[model samples]
Each structure stands twice: as structure tokens, then as C-alpha cells.
Target: MSKLENIRIEGIFIKEEGRKATLKFDMPFYADSQPVKWADSGYNSISLEIDIFDIHYLEIKT
Candidate 1:
């Protein structure tokens, strides 16, 4: 796997409400300007509520 593929996001699915869902992760998050790149800066464990509409697609791995 490439470096990007090796970047795993370990999180618990909180819930889905309307067109939004929340995730609670223990991993640090970085605000990347590019869609496929991790930025240099990052924040500690965080919970994020993201709009489903903003997502172009979803990928789930079993």
C-alpha cells in the first residue's frame, strides 16, 4: 500500500442525524488544503460532525 493508503483513521461512529454524521477519533487531525494529502499541522483527538452532502462518495472496508 502507498503512504496514503497506510494512513488509517481509527474512529467510532457516533451517529447519523438527517444529512450529517459524527465521528469520535483518538487520532490527531490535520487541516489539509489538498484532498489527498496530510498537512504538516494537526490537532489532538477530536469529534467531527460532517455534512453528508459535502461528501462526494463513501468508502468502507471490511
Candidate 2:
């Protein structure tokens, strides 16, 4: 499994007709189960897009 630590939400979009949603993250990093070593870590400048499907309940908090 992968882990995303200290990630910031950049954007969110929902499609009612398609019953899908997307979450965008900034400053994301790819890491495994091992302990994260910041000294050797590298930052990803690209944004991460996570596509989620299926309908249920949705909640948003700021």
C-alpha cells in the first residue's frame, strides 16, 4: 500500500449524473510502509487526482 502524508486538498468535483467524485491533492509524495525519511524524500510537483465512483452519502468540512 502507498501513503500520502501532509497532503493538502486542492480541489473537489462531484458529478451527480454519473455518481462520481474526484479529489485533487497537492504536494503529494509516494511512500511505502517503511518509516518515512524526509532527508531522502522528494516532493512531487504534480497534482494527484483520485477518482471515486458509486453513490452513497457525501460530506464536506472546512
RMSD to true structure for each model, in Å: 8.3, 6.2
Model 2 C-alpha lDDT per residue in residues 21-59, reported as the tens digit of each score: 999997555444434453346643557799899958788
Question: What is candidate 1's lDDT per residue for 1-62, written digit by digit as tens?
Answer: 52333334455352343334444333244444433322333433334433344444456675
TM-score quality measure for candidate 1? 0.26
Ten-residue region with minimum lDDT total, candidate 2: 30-39
What overall lDDT, based on C-alpha atoms, would model 2 receive against the true structure? 0.73
lDDT, candidates in the order shown: 0.41, 0.73
Clashing pairs in 1: none
The lDDT, on a scale of 0 to 1, for candidate 1 is 0.41
Best candidate, TM-score-wise? Answer: 2
What TM-score do all the candidates reach, one by one?
0.26, 0.55
